[model samples]
Target chain A: MSEAALLHNSLMLGAILFAVGMVGMVVRRNMIVMFLCAEMMLQGVSVSLVAWGRFHNDFGGQMLVIFILTVAACEAGLGLALFVVLFHRSGNLDITYWQELREENQAAFMDREVPEEDREKTIWPQLTPSGVEPAANPEEELHRSRV
Target chain B: MLTANEHLIGSAVVAALGLWLMLPPSGERLRALGLVVAASGLGWLMSRMPGLGTWAADAAFWSLAAATSAAAVATVVSRNPVYSALWFALSLLGTAGVFALQGAQFLAVATIVVYAGAIVVTFLFVLMLAQPDGTAYYDRVGWGRVTSLLACACPAVIVGVLAMMLSSSLAGFEAGTATVAELAANVRHEEHVARLGGTLFTDHLVAVELAGTLLLVALVGAVAITAQDRQKTDARKTHGGGASR
Candidate 1:
């Protein structure tokens, strides 16, 4: 393919990838999924950078992508650490647990409108037991609820 | 040309709609319908692409893009965080394939090693800690009805505007951009890494050093942050919170 056509095609594909990531970031409540979306966005940017480098026949774009990869590694280390701490504090990984960090003017996200799924309690799967059930410990129940 | 542009724009919107439907809290039947909708939308978009001037290469490119995009979509919609991480890994591999096909051998391998090897593994570790069983109530119900609609709208509009702007700028793209003519020497496939390394050390040596330092700092920071909380959790556990599932 011609250099220009290759550049255009690569860039268009990158843009599409970036848009998918943006939608994921906006819609997903899971902290891990949100982080994955951020990485996806970075992936999109990497694709564009490589394409640009190839088009110019220069190493600058690829070099920058290398740096981005490094930064992403650092980000993953720190972000996962943060998630672990936060999960420990709240016993859940819901982003709403930290909604206090939202902008001052923004209305709160929690207790907004309960979705159909959220309204109904989670139904844990059960199987028939051949033996008598052990009495549930309060401490174990607390841990189970947290899980 | 006008009709082509409309198809391009319309396809994007359709795909976004299908993706929104696939988000958490949807029924299995709805998800199936969304799969069809999303597939058709992507098909329309691919039909408009200026293929790589050959059928074989075009097929390869589209296949990679499709795999990558489909995985990304699944990652976004999956309620199970473990599944999301897995799907993201698949997407990363697909992207690496794209990079390899585009003559970026080193970068493709680097992406696979760094992201799939390290990053996804780290995510899975943390995910297992917080959610051993894949599904959680919060994961099941993503957002309230009104907010979900707005969430979908915001990204759709952003993507729509971006597409329109990019398309509009196509005519002026080549003229508006400047190339570094001095660094235009062609490198062979075998020497691609050699040349890339030379350029990195010569032109961007300081940046390389800075990146190393930044990584070290992040390492220290993550360790310290997690360690500080460990003592507190341990103390709490000792106080009759010794519950293990």
Candidate 2:
């Protein structure tokens, strides 16, 4: 293959890797696997960026890749935190089982007898199992239930 | 029958070798054999092409590429995180070869420092701290295989189409034709590091400082988050406990 063609082929490979990473991110249930998939995706972008930098005879893409690295680090940190919290609360990392963090909060609110208006404002610990404080007042009880 | 794209061709061969080694057969000796064979083949190919180079330099580059690819593939396929980290370091070294071949010495070294030195070390630390237990080969393979296959397909298709088009439009084709010697000479034109450093410090100083500050903050955050010893105790309450207790 010609040099240009070869380099272009590598870039295409990088793009395909990026796409697979994206799809994995969307489809994977395991948080750790999701992060790995994210890294894979980021690798694609990084390779393409560097390839472009070399191809264009410019250093801008390399510089941008530095920022990308920074962002990836930040993402890993945040994702790990979320993973830790998820594991602590749910004891499983399954994305499907993570519905408690999603729409199931409404069901929890209904079980607690929280009124519609107070449900949005009040924040409750999703994993606070069987901890109850005596109702001080009806209004406070409603709010606490939502919490 | 010496082609101008000898190094490029060698690089592709090495890339293929690296990808091929990532498949199965996790034996170190087997892996080493595959790597050696690939390197030897690269050397033989270069030797067959007249006017290419002396045996020593050709062998050096070929072995370098082979080693790099081998290490990278090993990292991806390894079950042990520590082993994976080591392999990652090797892979970075191989990627540096590409930069070097392209005549980007500063970029090559920067890749080594940033990726191998910083990124891989941090990953190692996280892996150690987490200590992800048990056999995870099935999980990694099932996902990795599907993703890798899907990823390889598009590029193959695109390259095939482009090649057909280029073949048809031969006169209009603008494939790069710089040889290894030409690229090396171009890269060594002057003190590239000095120019890069000057541009980075002066024109991009603030942004650089910002990155530094952000990294510092992250370091502090990681330390703070990981330093906590107790699972349930609040920081204030824990401190209130008497030493005698």
Candidate 3:
């Protein structure tokens, strides 16, 4: 097949992937999921770039993909750290919970108005029971506790 | 008339249906049906286009496209955050495959290593840490489904129109052609990694250095933010006697 046809096909695939990611970003509520969708969109753009580079017989597109990878890694690290802090404050991963950053006197449109009863409940992580319990025998306990 | 607008209409409808299926209102049965319809529509649209490249390459393209689109839709539609993350990884893998098919071996490997290996692990760690026990209410109940759908549809239509316009404009232009010997020589010269590295170190050196600085700054910022949070928690423990909880 001609290079033009191949480029067109790859571009089409990239466009579809990008649109899917866009929909995910708009519709998903979890902050991490939204971030992942953003990365997906980046991947789609990288694919198109590489395809275009091959069509033109240039390496510039591939070089740009490398830069995109670097930026994506940086984004993930910083975004995840911020997300962890946000979770600690609100005890949830919901994006709507982070309304404090909104402009002063701006009415929050995304905030969910949960009833007082539902708001009172805290969902703490439950530790699953695992590993061996400490042996009660004194001599055996001393041997087990050697670490 | 149908031939001209087939792909645009088909892709738009498929994407819109997929988005509809992902919305909170759709039940399991409807979502499943939507998935099937959307996949079929995408397949039909792909089939309408004339086959490009060798048979092997064409087969690979179609399968990778299917995998990429399916996984992308799954990432959006899955209710469980962990599952959504896993689907995202699968989608990334499919995208890497597409890059490989496009003769970007270096980029394919880099994408797999950076996105599938590192970034995905980071996302999973955050997902695990952020959610306490079970799925959160927001995961089950997406906000503003109709509004989001409308917003997304506008862009999809715009993209479809743009793609159609681009294809029509480029129809008369033929790609640069080379003899069989010249093609072989070009392939040998375009040693994917070497050319990429040459371009990066020569023409784009300043951009590369700036990217490195950006990464360093982001690292320090992340560390500072997390460390400050820890200090605040420790001070609160001392001053409030842990009663604030």
The per-model DockQ list reads: 0.40, 0.05, 0.36
**Per-residue lDDT of B122 in model 1:** 94
Ranking by lDDT: 1, 3, 2
The residue-level lDDT of candidate 2 at B174 comes to: 36
The candidate with the higher DockQ, 1 or 3, is: 1
Q: Write the per-residue lDDT of candidate 3 for residues B1-245, one digit (tens) a residue.
A: 47667677667676666667656546688787877777776776576554675898788888998899889888887888898889999998998898877667777788889889999988888887777465667776776556566756865676577567647745643445333355344432557567667778999999999999999999999999999988888999888767533
Candidate number that wins on TM-score, 2 or 3: 3
Clash totals for all candidate models: 0, 1, 0
**C-alpha RMSD over true interface residues, model 1:** 3.1
Residue pairs in collision within model 3: none
Q: Which clashing pairs does model 2 show?
A: A124-A147
Q: Which prediction has the highest lDDT against the true structure?
A: 1
Q: lDDT by residue for model 3 over A17-99, one digit each (tens)? A: 78878888878778888988898888888888887776666677788889999999999999999998888877788777675
The predicted structure with the larger lDDT, 1 or 2, is 1
Candidate 1 per-residue lDDT, tens place, A1-147, comes to: 444555676787787778788877877788888999999999999999988877666677889999999999999999999998888887888887677667889976666554446444565678877888789788887668565
Candidate 1: list runs displaced more than 4 Å.
Answer: A101-111, A114-147, B168-184, B187-190, B234-245
**Ranking of all predicted structures according to DockQ, beginning with the best and ending with the worst:** 1, 3, 2
